[model samples]
Target: MKKLISMIAVAALLITGCAKELKVTTAENLKVEYGEELDNTKLFNAKESDENVKVDKVEGFDAKKMGEQEITVTFTDDNKDKEEKLKITVEDTKKPVIELKKESVGITAGDKLELKDNIKSVKDPVDGDLKYSDKTVEKDGYYIDKGKLDTKKAGTYEVKVIAADKNGNKTEKSFKVNVKKKETAKKPNGTGNSNTSNNGGSSSSNPSNTGNSGSNTGSSSGGSNNSSNSNGGLSNNGGGQKPVNPAPHQHSITVTGYPDVVYSNMWFEDDTEAMYWASNYEGPNGDWAGFGYSSDQCSCGMWSPYFFNVTTWE
Candidate 1:
């Protein structure tokens, strides 16, 4: 029985005087191929013996040579009479590696994200299925897909990406996202007010023409100090009569009019008709005496006529 059989010398064809006989004995019929190895045992289709057992030239491929490689196989008969060989090649049919590009991102609400980096451009050692996330946000030349990230809400969020090839190779990565909050603007004066028209209807412009709010007291400027009212005081468009006085309405007047401010002594609105009272004091009966709006400049002085009647008594 010859154990180590290889391509060897062939006997010459015997020839007679008139004719010649060629002896071409066919070697055992065998097949061979190489493929990626799996973690578990694998079975290759080869001719089997009558006992249903594999009787090929090779037993099995070594797991270590799982990558692209070449395998040699031979087949022989039970009598160990002759043998033949076949060469097979194994290769990886999986795409290259994929990973996250950017590690972190900071953005405000209503902002969109672009996961361009992590998207796999392409890797080597491939042949079979090479596909990216179908659910990704595709753009001009980028594939953007995230596991868990919503920018609408205000808070920190995390985004992750995963990729796998047909060969069962997998890769995953993540990112940090910071979202900003929205803000609203506020009015300067800190108050909202409008006045009525002559016919007591809503008017775009309030004819009342107030000097502002706080403690203010002053006589009429250019306009007639006294109008045709029951009381010789400035009159509302309604013909209502109210006396205008020059008494300071508030203790302190933060006048935006003058470059400088008039922080009067607290006693300004306190003494006699004075409306100033450092501590909270309504009045001998009701609220304060003459305090209402900021002091408006008048020929007489700074005073708010609209506050209380300038004439008559308290």
Candidate 2:
């Protein structure tokens, strides 16, 4: 009988020792972007008795809502229910998108041009289509940065467009505006005149006294005639018009030695023009080298020294 009691006690002890408890491990806090759906597979890990367990469902979390919220996760282990609590935060960190109709726009000089005409749309995932704002300080719409747009000049100008969502998420993009010179009409040629004058007289009178030398004393009259003609020639070399100089040829310089520094479609009208533009180039992040051309060699260096060759085209 004591052996039987000992066996029963041993069995009970073994059963108690073999019993397992559900254990769940999860992050204390989760961060997600606005409009992102919650994914359960990435949330936590659950196991019981060295075996995997299944999550039944999750509660107390809304994906659409922004800000911090308490979340409760539920799972099942060995036909038993369990719950875990954590915090989730949904934020609007994504920037708005600015779509442009064209990367570069062309207009004649002295013509009216609106910056908004280049923009196709400005959209935010949460705020829909953004409106246009003249005030640069506003947060919910798009505005042009502080810069002058001179359509009266014939050159390339950069236009910066900034967009912001309702949550203060901002985006910036730029496009080029190429202003061209206007065409002029040509004038017609002028006419020239010529004049001629003739002053001459001829008289044929048979001088009978000439044959007879005796009467040579008769009165003899002689008259001389002169004729003059003046003709004016009009020369219309190019119709007295000024020669039209060709437009400034564009030259592209190839940059080398620096992989991090990138240049856009940049060109120079001439050596002087290139130096001037490079001197004024502000770069993308205020760290850029001004371009210089000397002795048929083109190079740029600010953060680091780099070299490039100049290519000319009409």
Candidate 3:
């Protein structure tokens, strides 16, 4: 009887070891963009303990759909079929694109200026074209950030256009609006007829009087008219010349060893300011100065310090 009990216990142990549960390793709570392609190899493991496993099929996953859903992955594990469920979220995180008609526009003072006219179009990859709005809180459209554009004043004003899509992705672009002073017509001089002789008609009646009158008219009127004409020419010449405002020079700077990484077409008052900005300008990675270095140590495996080249144009 003891020998019979030992055989039964050995059989039970063999059954338990042969029937061990198979646990599949899978990625949990995966997130993908709305239009990303699905790959089975990246989703889950295809082998268990050196045993060959194959992914047979996947279901309930839509690349075009935006939301969270449960996906079923079917695979053959060690000659046995099994299934695993995974939660995946599809989202739209792309920001909208803003195209402006002009980066800088000029208008005469007191002229009508519409802020929306500057925007050429606002388009989203998933949401199509976005509409214009007066307020910034609109989720599906764009709006001007600065309040009340003053076109009546003569000065330069900066305007920012902010666009947002349905998924809360946002993009911003800045532009300038220059308001020029209106020109007015100047009044003609009142001394134009002062050079005419008043005694010419009386001199025509008598020959003796004509000579005296002619001499007096020529002497007095010629001097007075010449003086008036000289002063008027000087005044008109001065008033006709307008003061010219110099255009801002375009400046650019590039990082050493990275030609593609550059800031171009930036406008500045002078080269001094551009140099200052380049010295302290911080980019996506870091500032131009001390690039590829951590404190005093060179992180790029060399003692090479990053240098910059600045170019400017009118």
Candidate 4:
């Protein structure tokens, strides 16, 4: 009976030694793409030569959500069971996001249309460096489909902008470009007249009265000097009509002796120096001429005629 017990123990030890052990050959930490299924066969080490050896169960792993997951792999060999627990990481499956900088922009007609300038920027959560492109909706007179603007007609237009990533994920945005007519420049000041006088001539009705001065000197019968008077005038409106807008011109005049200047109450008189304005001096009237006044009006005052170039607006 003792010998029979010894033989039974030896048989049990041989059976236990022949049984195969299950193991996982894959890495302890596995990474899988989102929305992908995990294969149990690839995660386990089973002897393909043995028909009874097979992957029995795989659980505790999900690829739908992005995070760390626990995966339990089990192998069965002839009713023997073994299990392996490991960690896996699931990544996002969604595409990148994109948006427009602005919904609309305004520009004048005949201006260059820079397509890229309108887009604020292209961004992606997973893919930071995204590809971008733009296109015009139509080949209309108001909008340019691409490149520099070719059309100048005033009208509203639309453009499509696209942002894409290497994963074939893409997003689109729309923009409205407004083309408007260009405005013209306005003339300086209002409708007024400019008439200037030269020498001792009196200014009647004149507009655009620039700087001008005039003076008159009287003489006594015995060659003695009489009292002198100075006059200056500025008129913005001349003769109730638009004053002649003269083109810019200049000329000079010389006097050997003082010439008597005719005075008018319409002008302002100065005891010392008088200012002459080209706008009020009609003597030069659309013609080039200069007006002169006494630099200093003493008891014996000297005066001379002045000349300057003049131009008239048509």
lDDT of each: 0.38, 0.63, 0.63, 0.50
lDDT of 4 by residue, 274-306 (tens): 222212244524342333332222232332223
lDDT, residue 313, candidate 4:
42
lDDT of 3 by residue, 68-157 (tens): 988998766656777888888898878899998755566777998788888999998876899998876558899997645687766667
Over 4 Å off in model 1, which ranges? 1-96, 117-130, 136-145, 186-314
lDDT of 1 by residue, 68-109 (tens): 333344323333322323333344344345444334555555
RMSD (CA, angstroms), candidate 4 = 23.8
The candidate scoring highest on lDDT is 3
Which candidate, 1 or 2, has the higher lDDT? 2
TM-score for each prediction?
0.31, 0.52, 0.52, 0.33
Local lDDT at 166 for model 3: 81
Off by over 4 Å in 2: 1-21, 47-50, 125-127, 184-314
Backbone clashes for every candidate come to 21, 0, 0, 34
Among all windows of ten consecutive residues in candidate 4, which has the lowest summed lDDT?
135-144
How far in Å is the alpha carbon of 87 misplaced in model 2?
1.0
RMSD of 2: 15.4
